[model samples]
Target: MTTFGAILKAHHIDYKLTNRSSLDEWFYSILDIPIDELSIFDISRSIRQDVFLEYVLPRAEVFLYEDPLAGDYDGQLLYDISMLTEAQPPSIMAILKRISAYLSQLDKHNLDSQSIKSIEKISALVRN
Candidate 1:
C-alpha cells in the first residue's frame, strides 16, 4: 500500500511523518496563534509568504512548497511548508512566482485562441 507521505510526494508535495510537533510549533509561531485555536481549514489563511519568512523557514532544515491540482481533496501541498525550520528559509519567492505564472495562464482561458496559445507557452515555461 502507498503511504500517505508517498502519495503526497508523488504529486510534488512535501511531508514529514515524524515532524508533527515541529510542524505545530512552526504553524503556531508564524500565525501568532495557538495550534488548537484553529481548524485544519484555517491553516491555509496563515501560509502567507511573509509569515513563512518570519516564523518557519528560518528554523527549518528543509522545506518545499507545491502547486497541486486545483480542488485537491488532500491538503498536502498547502501544508507541506510547515516542516521547515526557522534557520532554513526556503525559496518562497520562487515558489510564488511559479504559482502566479501558472495561475495567470489559467486565467487566460477567456482570451482568444492566439492568446490561449501564448498562455500555454507561458505555462510551459513555468513548468520548466
Candidate 2:
C-alpha cells in the first residue's frame, strides 16, 4: 500500500503524516480549511495541485524571468547539472525544501535578521 508519506515523497513535497486527528489540525491551521470540507481524495488532490502551482511554478518562473544581464546564469547552471537535463527540469524537490523552510519561519512569527538572511540566501540560490 502507498502510504501518505510515500505519496508526498513521490510528489517531492516535504510532509510528515501523523494520526488523522493531527493531520486534521494541521490542515485547519495551515490552510484554514476545515477537514470536514474535504475527503481524503480531495485533500490529496489539493496537496498535489498546491505543491505544483504554489511552490514549483513560481520557483521555475523566477529562473525564467531573470535579468538578461545576469548572463543566462540559471540556464548555464541548469545545463551544467546532469540531474536537470530534462526538457522540463524537475525542480519540485528544491521548491518543496524552500517552501517548507519559508512556512516554518512564518509559523514562528519571528522575522529577525536571520529570517532576512534566509530569504536572501534562497533568493540568491534560485536567482543564479
lDDT of 1: 0.37
Best by TM-score: 1
Worst 10 residues of 1 by lDDT: 58-67
State the C-alpha lDDT per candidate. 0.37, 0.37
Candidate 1: tens digits of C-alpha lDDT, residues 13-89: 66434556765555444342433343333334334333333223222212212222211233232233333223333
TM-score of each predicted structure versus truth: 0.25, 0.24
Off by over 4 Å in 2: 1-18, 28-111
TM-score of 1: 0.25
RMSD (Cα, Å) of model 1: 13.4
Clashing pairs in 1: 58-86, 58-87, 58-88, 59-85, 59-86, 59-87, 60-84, 60-85, 60-86
